[model samples]
Target: MNTSVVDCQKRLCPLRYLPRQPLSDPQASSQSASCVATSACESSALSFKRQAVRRSITPEFAKKVQSRSQVPVSRRSMRLQAIRPLRSLLHSKTTVSSALRPWGARGFASALVDKQVEGERITKVAELASEQAVRVTFEDGATAKFHKLWLRDHCRCEHCMHPETQQRQLDTASIPMDTPLHRLEVTDAGDAVAIDWDAPVRGTPCTASEFDAQWLRDHAYALEGGNAEDEDTAPYPKSYRQPRLTTQQLWAGADFQLPTHDYNKCVDNIEPLMRDLYTYGLVRVSDTPNSMEATEKFSKKIGFVLRTIYGTMWTTNPTNDAEGYNDTASTNLELLHHTDGTYIRDPPGLQIFNCAAQAGEGGESRYVDSFHVVETLRKENPEAFRVLSTTPLPYFTVDNDAHLATMEPLIRVDYAGNVVQFRHNDYDRAPLTHLSFEEVGEFYKVHRKLLEVLRRPETEFCMRLQVGDMMIVDNQRVMHGRHAFQGGDRALIGCYIGRTEYESRLRVLGII
Candidate 1:
């Protein structure tokens, strides 16, 4: 070692110009001393002074250059630089990088390593090579052979290809079992290894994360079949404990003639009609005249009828105010879909509305099946469904006058957990809980998606309710919104009914 070398000190330190020591000439130090003071006493004193001076200079130099005291390298800093170059490489490239199935963007590489290394994900793509050539063995004494091309097609890694979303996007149905390959290669990938197919098929490209997902799908036993898109099982009737409706005989008559003059039959039919509303979420009465008195009478009768048992359950919409009932305005517009009484823990069971004046232009009532909305969501946005089903949300409702309002999540599936219902009025929702922040964006995302799907005119069973038409619907299951209209004095008398009354009526009728 060159002890006198100043490689460690490029700074302007006083120690830089110090005299060099030669170990071999230690005995002749005084004799060869540059200073005239070569006596034993002077030599020893000079040596002690030099040693003290060198120590003081080195510390001062280090303090001056504190930032670069150690070698300019660190695990994090190196990773940062390493990550920078990968940013440009992340964009899509047309050619197959190699035969690893696309898994994820560059960022997922580390996660893939962690998951696979811990044995959390496994590979089930056995029968590595076949075509009357190679044999492959897997755990559980299973043995199979696949054409070399089959093994090549199963390469899982980025650079080879990547999945567009959370899971792999490859559809292996097109890959025939007879495709051949000359060789295959496997390379160490930090924790989980990456497979490289020597004969890179023109279309076979994948990212590293997709490789992990594929392995997990094949080996982890966690993957499910029959539409991974369908996430929530609860919305389906079988998943919930609540008894589903057995018969759908509300509109069985093909005559198209409305039920107008049958008073006893009409009132008798209310039980089954409202019961159908509960099971299906929405129901309608065929023939009632469009008159203010008739509609109000129907509304009042339903409220009064249910009030006998429901008590406060038949209360007016929170929109009704202390000042007085103001029923002048009309909801005959392009109203959006929404669930009723979202704010209440037990939302109103039945909603009664009569068409008092149907002379208005285009004020057809539209109803969307919320269950269908659930199915559509499950098919399209499974992750969003997961977020919604798992998260509790907030919702709000307004009094008839629109002056007072209450809030809760339109979909309340948690505490009373099994029952699915909504209290949606995008315009009326106010905060009800603040448990998880992730739900803020998730709630809005799901609501927006549902709204988009629900607004489709096809989903809405639109009907022109004349002056005499009265309808009773399950407030929880059905979302009622009206189309825009002009010209006529469009008005309807609306009222709420209790769940207990509605259920009792159903039992009395034996329609359940």
Candidate 2:
């Protein structure tokens, strides 16, 4: 009930007008006069009025009125006020607890983390070159010296890179024994290095890291002034731009094989070979029997092995599947410089191809190192690179009706916006949805640029395989294509390996 209405009822009662106290202290005067008046009124005819009013106010209604008076001090309001500071304190406590955990205990958080902390931290071998090695101080205050030989061996020079090939041209013997390293100096730029060494006893500068003729003159000990600009010493991009496996590092074998002559011994080589593929995107096996059926058997073996881990074979079985309408597998010379399965979420981890025959003709297989292409694109066309890197192209999949398709972007990024993988296939491009026509045109333009880079003769490397030349690669990083074959009826067998087994096999061999 409204307080005004309650006051009106009180006034109407016979006891209401009896109190008369106008005093300096309002609280004391109202209490005393109201009490005396209440007693006098109860004693007289007003007693009937008091009893009626009391009877009208039910216990539940009185309780509700009392509850309304205590609204500001309710349990929910009190509880929320009580918990506000505590919630903040609890969050702070959790943050501190996580920070206190041991370095080794962090979860699979990142590969970069594992590589830096676990592998590079402890195993960064010391260097004793003429130049000063950069000292890597661990969290515990201990430091390790990294040498120029180590730098030279693991040079990221182009000559060492396998743009389209995975051959290790660095024979330790190739490093001159007589060459004396004077000192080692590392520049902050792109981790570049400058080394001063004694004159080569034989075969150019021995123990040189990415020895371009121009680089040699720039840092050469005996450079004549006039000979610097000579055509022979013309400035060229460093050969060390190529990627290479670190010297003396033995990788565990899982799938790929090096030059093992014995068949039984090849079993042990699998993990390292697989690790090489994981790290470098490619690996090779030599001296298998030369036959198309043999190649198929090799491919099938890889498939069967992969299925054990992946749980299902995801090969595009063109012969049996009606869904694979656009699945074209031909012996025809198509330079398919394209990635496989951009339509799927996680594409194939590894691709295994076995060469049936190499008739010594022009049907040599070509591989484009997409990773190297990415590096090149970054260097040459930074603006175009930024556009391609920022924009997303819809990677797609379709049913028999090309109209019915699902699409995702060709480039996938993490929450922090790091480019994780690139998935693109011309075959599975779905129609643009949110993007404008102009944006789509820009996408195609950049895409075509990427394709052109892939097809460049300098960018791609070709290898003619003899019978029994089987290769496995990280499918996401490498793109394979073939040349026009003059000889009749040549075929290669292929299969895919998923990443789970590919990695587990590496761990089993202790390579990772």
Question: lDDT per prediction?
Answer: 0.42, 0.43
Give the poorly placed runs of model 1, Cα more than 4 Å off.
Answer: 1-264, 268-279, 289-333, 396-407, 414-419, 431-438
**For residue 502, what is the lDDT in candidate 2?**
54
* RMSD of model 1 against the true structure: 29.0
Compared with the true structure, the alpha-carbon lDDT of candidate 2 equals: 0.43
Which one wins on TM-score? 2
If scored against the real structure, what TM-score would every candidate get? 0.42, 0.44
Q: What is the per-residue lDDT of model 2 for residues 1-512, given as tens digits with 9 covering 90 to 100? A: 11211121221211211112123454554454344333422333223333222222223433333233221212222221222211121121222111111111111111101111121112122344455343333223334344444434543222342211223334445545434566544433212244555543222333334222122222232223333344232122222111122222222223223432322234323334544555666667776655545544544333333432223332222232443434443434455666766665567767776665453467777666676676566677765566676775566554445433335555444554444466666766666676788987877777777667666767665677666677776677677766766654455556676665454334323333
For all candidates, the clash counts are 50, 26
